[model samples]
Target: MELINNLGLGFTTVLTFQNLTYSFFGVLLGTLIGVLPGLGPLVAIAVLLPFTFALDPVSSMIMLAGIFYGAQYGGSTTAILINLPGEASSIVTTLDGHEMAKQGHAGKALATAAIASFFAGCVATVIIGLFAPPLAKLAFQFGPAEYFSLMVCGLIVSVVLASGSLVKAFGMMVLGLLLGIIGTDSQTGLQRFTFGIPELADGLSVAAIAMGLFGLGEIIRNLESVKSGSMQVSKVTSLMPTRQDLKDIFQPMVRGTMLGSFLGVLPGGGALLASFAAYALEKKISATPEQFGKGAIAGVAAPEAANNAGAQTSFIPMLTLGIPSNPVMALMISALVIQGIEPGPAVISEHPELFWGIIASMWVGNLMLLVLNLPLVGLWVKLVSIPYKFLFPIVIIFACIGVYSMGNSAVAVATMAGFGVFGYILKKLECEAAPMILGFILGPMMEGHMQRALLIARGDVFTFFREPISAALLILAAVALGLVLLPSFQKTRSTALVDED
Candidate 1:
């Protein structure tokens, strides 16, 4: 009864004439961005955030969140129609989705992706409705000690799951932490890391960093190996899946949704991890493993479901625990902060409308995606034909204009340009920027919690271990750290053996 009432409240809020309009535009624009290669939701949301300042918080968030998941849907179109993946989460989809397109099943593959995504999105919304209350109840259980410990564990999980060398991941995380501290000291009111720059006092702009690294950096990279012309798209037949296609995908979709929902709720394991993990699990469990990647419908079905489910459920930690699981969630939290609404457990009680409205908007957004993807399949294919020469300038202009709009400051442009160059360097080094951004996002919160916990403990070093919940979390972190290091140890030993031989 309570759940139904919450849903009612959400719909009442979302069904407002203003919100419905923005929500539709959000998904429509998200789909357009997702069909383009190298343009992810992270860039899309960051680029468009400035325009939403005039609207109410709920409406703005509704639109941005739509873009986030809408990208997940649009990315599938590119993956199916062309061999290239528009988003990293859709890379696995291209392995089989593109193959299915080659086998003259392009329409069927696209239809399957849309349907599976819708099913997963609906299931994920239910999971949110059921699990969020219980999880938010945790606010009462966590003191500074517990919160600090949890953040530590979250950071470790980030390093463990990040792609590339362990040393490099840790290095990036440390760099992010350093960058996070570049602003004025919150407690002491002292200016640190300003280096005599006045803008540094307010700290680095999130908009600047996000646009520089993801938006401008992407355009720069895409320009280097520029394509002379647009590539051909596969011919899409009837956009209806047959009886066999549905039968094959039903079980896989369920499994993917379940897996994605669980991972997406974790502080560090988000949609990227969920999608990859789901694909790996499906390939491992399929009856005919040999057919797994050779145009298997299940391949397209599972990962698409997983990525969409993961994208929806990734909101869980951000809403309930006040911890962002990924950069996209971090941006959402920033949006809430800008509205003077602190993210965390009390959000449900204090701002029930915002909480439930966002949740309900997800389902509406998913429905919109289903309607958009099927009939507009032809449109997305045409978009794929848009030349990079044309798209790159628009993206570059958007990045510059969006970053400059923040506080009407020119410093944001300089900051974005620096980070754009830095992002390119990281790409050259094969080091990921995701973990670095995660560290940047979580650093201040973790530091604040640690400071408070230590103050409460009167400088006792063992206070973290003395608290039961904190102790268990620290233990878990230690074990995870050990596991992360074990592979490196084994590799080093093997190398030594080879040298001796």
Candidate 2:
């Protein structure tokens, strides 16, 4: 009954003319970004952050969130049509999606991705409406000890969640946390890592680091790869999935939704991890495992569903706890802060309309994606043909503009350029930037909470393990760290290494 009332209220808030217009535009632009190579949602949202200053917070967030989720639908279009996964989450789709395209079933592949995304998005949004308030209430019970322990858990999880060497991920995360301390101290009136750069006093702009590491980083990598050849594009067909296709996808969709919805609530698990994990899990359990790399419909369905579900559910942590699980959500939290909205447990009670309205807008946005993706996929395909020469400059331009617009400072531009160079070096060394970005996003929160917990405990470090929740968090962190070091797990990884002939 409570869920139904919230949905009704959500609909009322989303039905407004202003929100509808922005939602539509958001999905459209998001699709455009996803179809283009080397531009992910992180860069998309970062590049667009400056423009949101002129809009209302709810409207801005609604649009940004739409773009974040909508990119999932758009990304698979390229993964199937061009064999280029527009976003990291869509990489799994390429195994089967592109093969299906080659067999003249491109339309079915795209249609399946779109429909499953819509279905999963709907389920996730409804779940959010039902669970968010209770979750918010639970969050209200967290004291500094709980929050600090949670931060420890998040930081430790970063090592396990990272793709490469655990040591590297931990090193990068520690570096990020140290970098986060560059500005004026929150608890004291002192400067730490400024090195006398006047702009450092204001701290590094999230926009600068994000745009540089993700946006300019992509440009640098693509520039190095400057390929001299092109491949044959697949011919698109009917956009409808057959009955058999639906039957094959039904179970995976359900499983993906359940898994992603739960994991999405975690502090560090975002759509990218959810999508990759779902793909891996589905492959492990399928009766026809060999069909996975050869255009299995479930391969297209499961991860696509998981990514979309995770994308939507990721809003829970940001809204209810003022903690962002990913860079994209971090941008949303920043937007809310800029609007003078302190996002926390009390947000639900204080700004019920904004809270419920954003929830409502998600459902509406899913509908908008369905309408937009079904008939307009061909247009998205056309974008794939856009020359790299014409495309990259625009991305670079938008990136520069967005960074500069933050406080109208030239320092931000220089910061972006410097980090772009740094990101390029990391790319050259084959170091993954996703973990770095994740570290950047989580670093400050983890630090503040750690100190708060220590302060509240009056120098007693053991208090974190005294509270049940905090102890549970600590135990989970310990187990995660242990598993990552286990010899058996390490052996399985080595056995899977590709052997060159």
Write down the TM-score of every candidate: 0.96, 0.95
Worst window of 10 by summed lDDT in candidate 2? 492-501
Q: Which ten residues in a row have the lowest lDDT in candidate 1?
A: 492-501
**TM-score result, candidate 2:** 0.95
In terms of TM-score, the best-performing candidate is: 1
Measured over all alpha carbons after superposition, the RMSD of each candidate to the real structure, in angstroms, is 3.5, 2.1
lDDT of each: 0.86, 0.81
Residues 23-112 of candidate 2: C-alpha lDDT, one tens digit per residue: 888888887777777898788898889899999887888788888988888888889988988887788789889999888999899888
lDDT of 2 at 395: 89
Error of 1 at 160 (Å): 0.8
Cα RMSD for predicted model 2: 2.1
Candidate 1 residues 191-310, lDDT tens each?
888999887898888778877887778777888976676676899889878898899999989999999998887766777777777877788899887896789999988889999999
For model 2, the superposed segments whose C-alpha errors exceed 4 Å read 228-231, 493-501
TM-score of 1: 0.96
